[model samples]
Target: MSARQPHELLLAARPVEILGVALSPVEYSGVRVMTLTMIDQVHKRPDGTARRNFNEHRARLVMGEDFFELNQPNEIRALGFSRPQGGTPAAVLLLTEAGYSMLVKSFTDDLAWDVQRLLVKSYFAKPAPATDPLASLPPEQRALIALMVDNASIKAEQAAQSQALAAQAEVQAEQGAAITAVGQRVGDLADTMLMLARPAGAESIVHIRERINKLHGLPSRIIDEVLRQSPIAPKPAGMVKHSREEARGGSYAVYWIKDVSAVFARFSGECTRITATQVTHPYIDGRFKLLPARDRP
Candidate 1:
């Protein structure tokens, strides 16, 4: 397939397993700088465009020096896995056993939120009505995921309530405007994509339903299509959505995500838990001040 524009590229991201992945430190010019400012921009423009520069930094990153490591485990977590045999199926909300196994290894507070969002969307597949879906997590990590999910659920429910209040207010205000209420209609997924044939702004998977909720004339999907293709559509950072398909023993499920790193980094600033400093050494006596000093008083 041709390279997708960045906004649309999220659509192509699919859930795949991480194999042979390990986290190690970097050697910035023989200096070990341990701290990682996860969301630092290398070549991002003023308008948020990450310029496609294929030079030293981009080239090295593309070559995969350090993939996002969820939490700390020190020189472990095999990230250097062989290329997956088949094309990585678009990362779905539900990952394959191997993929999820690798994923949980790197789970962090950020990841727990992501899992909750997916589970909410797949409300039908929630493990239990009031129970936490992350129950399967290890005892050490379970509390963390559980706490994160509880907070997220509360927030999401609150947001939904706020949206409802806003809508009610809008309806009341528009009552005198005689805005005719529109009823439901139906269309398949492709028709929905056609609406975004010319996307206005970036749209992430999470806001689709909410966007669709505001329209009052035609079908919700139509409203979604229009908003998604409108100039104000959001450019979501992390998750992707694909055509509906059977996933996790359920149908009509099609959300996928690839860059948990971007998700966590964007929301919480600095997403990774494992990053070592590039060795920072002053002098080798024989070659005093080998590297130029970054600061001179």
Candidate 2:
């Protein structure tokens, strides 16, 4: 008698669990056999008034393979087949040894059971087939499916809008910080220029005014006022003095002015001073007066 085929023997055995569900594959002689099993379990609560319930269903599909290999046992198990070594071989080989090992590793280690369950549930319970043979679906179920689709679309739009808004807010905040920083720098520069322009004793007001104009971009009139508020010294003797008469036309006459009054005179006889003829009218309305030659003691 000829040896029994592996597929024939496999069909005779009961179904086994691979990942979580029990599965089996059967070959028929003439007619196609399709089997579906639904298993329901309930556990009573401590109060006996409530029960936790679960329903699991599986569908068996018949597929053909040419050969089988032994390296990966779990892959065959998941597909409702025994390990290659545990069964007799047919004339045709289905999968190579290396392929079987890779499949088994992917099934046992790489695939997540929770994600698989969610996918299965979504496929079987959520979507409706175009040609479902079932007689009728309840109104509530149709409404629920519609609501779920609408809610998913709304959530996606909301998430996108929220991300865009967050990005805009971040950009605005950065711009605001940069503007504040620039304002602070300008204030600091102005303060530094003011400090440098402050006049001390024996410093020429004109020289201080010129420095202030260069450093702070201030008008010459503002520089002069700043210098006038500060201390100054008398012009030294023997310094060449230019008269305003020589200051006519486009030329300016630079001269030294001597102070012979008050504290500056008590300490020193004379200090160097600078006077420049005005080419443009001073911004402040004031007359530039040359000090009367010091009265002879």
Candidate 3:
């Protein structure tokens, strides 16, 4: 047969077991590196039963050197194997009887050549197109296109910035309103506390209850803050309802506090104790009833 081409030779050697596959860059030039492991096995029948045993073989292969050059230590050395200085240079390693048999049985020249060709094809393919078809316009046209894109980008960025600012402003306004509302409610709660702390003879539970009832109409934050500063325990679990006569002489407003004590206790145990201005009535004889606070008229 005629001598194989360079590519064909590379392909044939592709599957050859290299002793030390240089996983990293090496000091030598024009030398491709690879590391591989070898396994040996024996099959036998033990007492009429089939069995197999395995052994491991390891070696490094240094290619591309003449038979006499391979023995040189400086030429190819990776792992434990190295070429002796100024010895018979050979491209192929001299394997022992077992090693030779194993390699011969495990790999074929055709498979090695085929794999090498595939590796060459994969690594040395044609370059890809750098730009899309639409991007390859005349110089003036491209400049105009780029300018348009820049302007659109600027406009989108400006709109987004404006929207973020507006949202931030709106949030700030809501926060300011909530703060003011909470301050007013806190003032009202202070008044109620003062009334409750009055002398026993002058104490008016009705008035205190009325003041607390007004808190129901306040914003949730104010209500929470008032409760935070009051001495009353948190509302108990389950549903709670309070019916109160309006301070302005209107119909009674019915309010519900779900898990009132639990919610109150979340912010309890501070210098300022929060008490509920209302009470819940239990179901009596399978019927629900509304009972006013003892302080209520």
Candidate 4:
């Protein structure tokens, strides 16, 4: 190798600044600025106005990589009007992350409470779906309080709907029971009319229906429903025949009554076995095959 040149070692050292400007009495946000060095230069305009310039005043009104936190006086002062070191920048006023949060984020009344809750929490956070796992993991700074609030609101709505449905079901069950009871009362009225009154003694069907409703203390709704829907409700016209008597003068739309004895006697031409439970039934077993005098032979 050739011998090293006399200036070979100088190439490795940082270059020294031999040039700069100077100015003073400078103020920033009410604070007096002091520079490391100041030099004076004067220029006389053609109009005879002299403008003196500072070689480095505007070059670095403010500069540094370190952020000047506006909220904290100490951090702001920490910037200290010094030149940048290493790769750090110069002449910049830093806007802190917290500063942007207060300035940019806004909430209306509906979401205000959720934001309040979120502010109190120190360390729970979720990330955006599109964010990378590497960026999200070990989260030193992030939160998903808004999403949680949305979920809680949805659950509250669902619970309210479920309660409403349950109440509707209860009302429907009560209505069904009332209809069944009204039907039973109307059935009893039919059997009584069948056994005790012949056409000559019977009243008008409409009149009899009102009497039965009043006698049973049935509500108007129940009364109307019974007349409309009950199988045993006396119709506006007709008659039902029975053993030994063909009664007329009321709708025969009466519900079935099990009086095997009555039914047997009517069909068989006999007046025996009148003690059978009065319900609607063809027969319990083939024993009913013995019914009717003519069929037996």
Candidate 5:
């Protein structure tokens, strides 16, 4: 590597004499900037003065536009600035020209005015020409530029992976819902098929009640009421002569299974009306109860 000329060395050290304090050269995103330490030193303010001011107006400041922070020691050191006395700092803040203006807005002293004018002109205003930018910047500043580009690429890749995972989860949720709906529909079809496949013959009242129970799984009270109140003298076309031990003189009339559906329909309508009115069942405890005045049915 060729040695820097005498005039180049003078240019490098000029900011210290111009600002009345030792200010490091820091640049980022192809723009010259000042660190918090550099700003405090150049402005003759107390250590951490710039940091305090930054914290106070942090909400209004836009990151990447007003300032940048380097958390890693390697990245911070890449700026070639002096490390804090104790050890490497956890973060180093880089302030742009606009950021510096905002940070020292409250300082109106003559010294503040003079320092700001000189630094803006002699230090921050100087930029390397576009034709050969890296040729002018030191090796450390070039390394920092490469590091920032790599970090931005990594962040973009991570964002794409997160979006893909979210889309996959949404598709899985939709598939699960569709499967559940199909299962419910299949169960309903099975129940309907079982109800329609009854045997073709006249059935005794007891047998009819059992068949209804198997088909509907209805509450016991509903079936009991329908069997007790249906006409005892069955329809001529639907009745069958039967002899049963439990009947008086061993004789009883049974109903055709096909005709029993009408009785079920009529009695079910009455049960629904009673349920809607919130009235007590007619045959509770084997005794009929009059409808209450509050019941509309």
Candidate 6:
């Protein structure tokens, strides 16, 4: 079949689950095509691994027939990706079944083989959704069907209302749990304040972050970046003991808190009003679920 445009596919695609991953479906022409991001996740490869494979083997692959490149923001956004928070992606590479087969030729693992089989048999070759049986009926027949649907909906609504009332106690319990979480967050703030009152001596990034978090209200990640990258920020005094299981070799570098404190206060203060915003991209994870045609921008 001739490939339809990306926008056309957006109307017909529906979400599907494979190996516990919820894939945001995208079809081109009549065949399902997956982005490099999706391919990386579905195959358990690191992020950008698929893209790296494609780039390394581009000389052997055919364009338009085997793969399609979407560089325009609107084109990519139509596939259910939100705009990048920082900047635009260079290009989003979408691969056909043929392309995927060619790209992963080196992935000889059992999991790779199983996933390829499933993608071919279940994902790419899956049948389209059946059309509504009543869609082609006469006006009079359609009216009769609509009336029946309305009556059934009324009964369902009544049943739903009863269920809602029964679920109210569970809702109250959830609210109480939320309140307890708020109290725990308050305790964390108190700990941060206590750390702040201590002498302005050397401390680990982990410890210094708490004070910065309490004073500047910036995320730990952002604070870490600012301190690490800023020229004015001081270097680590020496390595400190780390007891956390996540730490490698059970040790990490510790910086002087006095140096980092000034850097955090300066940068965090510059951004006085920080609006909470989220920019999501399509992944096997449902962080960016496939939006319906009506919901797509």
TM-score per candidate:
0.15, 0.24, 0.33, 0.23, 0.37, 0.39
Question: Per-residue CA lDDT of candidate 3, range 141-251, in tens?
Answer: 988888999999999999999999999999999999999999999977654443212333221223324444453232344343344344443431221122233533222
Please say which candidate is ahead in TM-score: 1 or 2. Answer: 2
Instruction: Find the candidate with the highest lDDT and give its number.
Output: 6
Q: Which regions of candidate 6 deviate over 4 angstroms?
A: 1-7, 11-14, 83-87, 128-297
Q: Candidate 5, clashing residue pairs?
A: none
Candidate number of the best TM-score? 6
Query: Residue by residue across 164-239, what tens digits does model 2's lDDT show?
Result: 9999999999999999999999978654433222223333446544543443333555345433432443333221
C-alpha positional error of residue 142 in candidate 4 after TM-score superposition, expressed in Å: 6.5
Q: Tell me how far the alpha carbon of residue 128 in candidate 1 is from the true structure, in angstroms, after superposition.
A: 18
Q: Give a tens-digit lDDT track for model 1, residues 54-167.
A: 122333441112222223222222212222464322211112222222323323456444543442243213234587666777997988877898999999999999999999
lDDT of 5 at 280: 35
Q: How close is each model in CA RMSD to the real structure? A: 45.4, 19.9, 18.0, 25.4, 20.7, 33.5
User: Runs in model 5 with CA error above 4 Å?
Assistant: 1-16, 78-83, 127-297
lDDT of 5 by residue, 19-138 (tens): 447665655765566778777777788998888999999887778778876677765454454554655677878778888888889778998899889888777777555696677899
CA lDDT, every model vs. true structure: 0.32, 0.37, 0.36, 0.36, 0.63, 0.69
Clashes of 2: 9
In angstroms, give how far residue 60 of model 6 lies from its true place: 1.1
Mark the 10 consecutive residues where model 3 has the least summed lDDT.
Answer: 42-51
Off by over 4 Å in 3: 1-114, 126-129, 132-136, 196-198, 201-297
lDDT of 5: 0.63
Write the residue-wise lDDT of candidate 4 on 1-297 in tens digits. Answer: 155431111121322221222222322332222222211121111221111122222242223211121333343345443334543223433312232123223323444434324422311122336855446545433245556778899999999999999999999999999999999999887766554333443444355445543443323443344345544343433244444444344334332223212332343332234324121222221122122333232
Better of 1 and 6 by lDDT: 6
Cα shift from native, residue 97, model 6 (Å): 0.6
